[model samples]
Target: MFYWRRVGRIWPVHLVALPLGIYAFYVAAKVDIDWPGLISSVFLVQTWFPDVTPTLPGNPVTWTLSVELLFYALFPLVAPFADRMRTRWLMVATAVGLFGMYLVNWVADATLDPTMARWVMRHPLVYLPEFLLGMTMALALRRGWRLPLHPVVPLAGLFGWTYLYYQERWPFSDVVEHQMEFAMRPMVGVLSALIILAFLQREARGHRGILNNRLLVSLGLWSYSFYLVHHAISRLATYEFGRMPDNNAVLFTLIGMAVVINVICWALFTYVEEPAEKWWRKHTPKRWLDRGGETGGSALPPAPRREAETAPAPV
Candidate 1:
C-alpha cells in the first residue's frame, strides 16, 4: 500500500501509543503481582506478549501491533489485490466477506478445540482482511473514488471509538473484540485519505495547507523512531516508578518520566532506526535482472521497490 510506505514515517502515532503504554504499565502494576510472568514475558523477546502488554488495563489495544507487524510483512502482496478490485461495490463486498468470516470465527470459537481456537485468534491469516481493507482504501483513493472528506467524520469516529474503548461495556467490548478489530482501519484510513486529497486539491487550486508546514513534516519524519523505542522506554519508567501511590505527585512523576523517555526515544530514532533503515536500503542487493546479471537462486527486487513492484498492477 502507498500508505504503508508512509507508515515508515509515522512518528506521531507513537506519541499516542507511548502515553497509553505508560498508562498500561501503571495499571498492570496496580492490578496484581505477576513479577515472574511479567519479567519472563519481557525477556522472552520472541513473542508479541512481551513487546506490548496485551492484557493490561487501559491498553487492550496493543494486540494490534502483532497484526500491524503481520500487515507490514504482507502489505506488499495485499496491495495488489486491492488495486485490482475496480469498483466500490467490489471493495465493499470484499470487506463484508472478511467481516463475515470473522463473525463465523466468533461463532466457531464456541465449539472449536481450545488449541485451534487460540491459533485462529492469533494467526496472521486472520488479519489479512483488515490489512487488505486498508490496502483497498488506498487503492480506491488512488483511482479517484470519491468519499466524503468532512473533518467531522474522522473526529466523530475517533471520539466514538475512544468513548466505546473506555466505557468497557458489553456491546462495545464485543464490537471492539470482533467487529471493531479493524476500527482504526476506517478512521485512520478516511482521515489520512481526506488529508491527502485535500492537500492535492489545495495545491491544484494554488493554496497551501498546514501539512506543508516544516515542523509537521519533520515530526512525521522522526515518528517511526519514536515508535520503535517508546514502548521500551515506557516500560522502563513503569518498572522504576510504578509502585508508587497513584496520587498527583506520582502522576506528575510518571508524566515527567514519560517525557524523558520520549526524548530518548526520539534520539534513538534519529540515530538508530532512521540510519539503519537507510543503510539497509542502500546496502541491500537489487534484483539480478536490474543489475544485468543472470545467476543466483532468485533475484528479489530491492527491498524498497519489492513492495511496490510486487503489488498487483491495477486492472
Candidate 2:
C-alpha cells in the first residue's frame, strides 16, 4: 500500500512535470543538458550518481525525489525492526545515527575532494538518519512520551541559526565554522523534529489555533504539486527574464510570483495528483497491499503489517 500509494501520488505530477520541464530547458531555450543526468532524472535516481545529479537535469529540483525514493524503499524494511525496539532504544539509535550523519560529512570534508565530498555528504543514505529521527519521534509519541516545549523555541532557533550562518556572525575559528557548516543539515533535522513534536503534543492535549485553519489545511493538500513545479517556473522566469535587480522590490515580485505559481498548484493538484492517486487506489490489486492475506504471494506477518499501515504523503 505504501509503495502503491506513493507511486500513484507522485508519478502523475512527475510525468507531467518532467517533459514540460525538459521542454522548458531544451526547447523553450537551447540549454545544453547531459543525457545521462536526464536519464537518471527520468528514473528519479539521479542523486545516486555524482556527475548526474544534485545537478538535476530534466527538472532542476527533482534530485529530492531521488533522496525520498531511497527512503520509501528502505522504510518498510527497517520499520518492522524499529517497531520491535523499546521507544528509548529507538530514540537512542536515532540520535546515534544523526551523530553518524555528522561524522560522515566531517570525514568526507577532511578526506575527499570537494566534488566527492559534496556527493558523499549528500548521498541519499546520508539522509536516512533524519528519517530515523522522525520515525523515532512518532514511535516515542505513540508510546506516551512528551516533554514540555514551546513551538516558538524551535522556530526562533532556526531563525537565529539562519541569521548567524548568513551573516557570518558565528564567532568561531575557520575550522569550527567548517564543522558548523557540516553540522547544519543534521541540526536542522533536530529543530524540525522539535517543531513537529511541539505542535503534535499541543494537538494531543486538545489545543487548537491558527494551524487548524481550513485555508492552511487546504494549502497543505496542494503543497506537493506546488513543490513539483515552483522551481521550474522560477527557473523559466529567470531564463526568459534575467534575475530581478537586488533590491527590496524583488520581494513583491516574489509575492506576485508565488500567487501565480499557487494558482497552477491548485489546478495540478485537483486535476492530476489527486485524481490519479484516487484512481490508483481504486484500481490497485489487493495483492500489492499484501493485506497479510492468502492473495498476497509473500504477505507480511500480521503483527508487522499492523504497525506499518499509514500511507505517508510522497513529499
Candidate 3:
C-alpha cells in the first residue's frame, strides 16, 4: 500500500520528466547520452551501477530519487525497530547513524575509481544514515523531546556551512571536489534534524512563522513537481539563453527563469501530481493489513501519515 501510494504520488511527474530529460540530453549534445543508462534511470536503479555509464542520462536530479527509492524500500523494515527506541536510545542511534555515515565515506574513498567513487559515495546505502537520523529525530519528537538549542543556531550553522562551501572557504575544498561534501552529510543531517524539530515544536504550539507562510507553503506543495522538472527546465533555459556577459545579467536571467519554471511547476502539480495522488487514494481501498484484520475495517479514525511517509524521499 505504501509503495503504491508513492508510485501514485511521484510516477506521473517522473514519467513526464523522463522524456523531457531525454530531450535535455539531446539538446545538450546529440551523441552524449547512453540509451542503456537512460533505461536504468527510467527504472530508478542507475545509482546501483557505476558512474561510468551515464549517471543522469534521463534526469540528472532523479539520481537522488533512485537513492530515495532504496530508502522507501527499506523504511518498512526499519520503522518498526526505530519507533520502539527510547529517547536515550535515540541519541545513541543518532551517533551510530553518523558513525555509519563516516564509515561509508571512508569505504567509498578507499575503494572505487574517482568517478565511480563519487557514485558510490552518493549511493543509497552511503546516505541511509541520514535517513536514519531523520527517523530517529521524528521518533524523538513524537516522544516529546524538546529542542536543546535555539532553532536559529542550527539553521545558521547549516546555511553557514553551505555558504562557506559555495564560497570555496571550506578547508578541504582544494584537496577534493566531492569527498569533503560527502564528509559533511552527518553535520548537515544533524542541523537539519534540529531545524525540523524546532519547526515541529513551533507548529505544535500554534506559532506562525515563515515555515507556515502561505506562499512558502504553497511552494512546498509543488516542490516535488519542481524537483522533477527543474533540471530539464534549467538546461533548456541555458541552451536557449546562452551565458550572460555579466553577473547582474546572469542573476536577472536566473530569477526570470526561476519564476517561469515555478509557474510551469505549479501547473504540473495542480494538473498532474496532485490529481494522480488523489485518484490513487480514491481508487485504492485500505489494505486489510493496515486495518489490522481481513475485514478491512477499523473503529478508530485513520491517523495522519507522517510527512516522511509522503516526502519526496530525496537525499
lDDT of 1: 0.51
lDDT by candidate, in order shown:
0.51, 0.80, 0.74
The model with the greatest TM-score is: 2
- Per-residue lDDT tens digits for candidate 3, residues 233-310, read 787777887756766667877788889989988998989888887887666665634654433242223334454442
Task: List runs of model 1 lying over 4 Å from the truth.
Answer: 1-81, 101-105, 108-119, 168-213, 243-255, 286-315
Worst 10 residues of 1 by lDDT: 296-305
Candidate 2's residue-wise lDDT over 1-315, tens digit each?
667767887788898888778877776767776788888888888878888633557886787888889888887788777777776687888889999999999999999999989888878999999878977887666656677888999989988888887787467789988988888999999998999888988898798956899989888988988888888788789888899999999999999999999999999988998889888878778665566333223212223222333322121
For residues 9-126, could you state the per-residue lDDT of candidate 1 as single tens digits?
3333443444454455555456553454344322222123322233322233334554566676665565455455555655776568576556646654666775555545555556
Instruction: Give residue 124's error in model 3 in angstroms.
Output: 0.8
Candidate 3's C-alpha runs over 4 A off are 170-179, 285-315
Task: List the RMSD of every prediction in angstroms.
Answer: 9.0, 5.4, 6.1
Better of 1 and 3 by TM-score: 3
- The residue pairs that clash in candidate 3, if any, are none
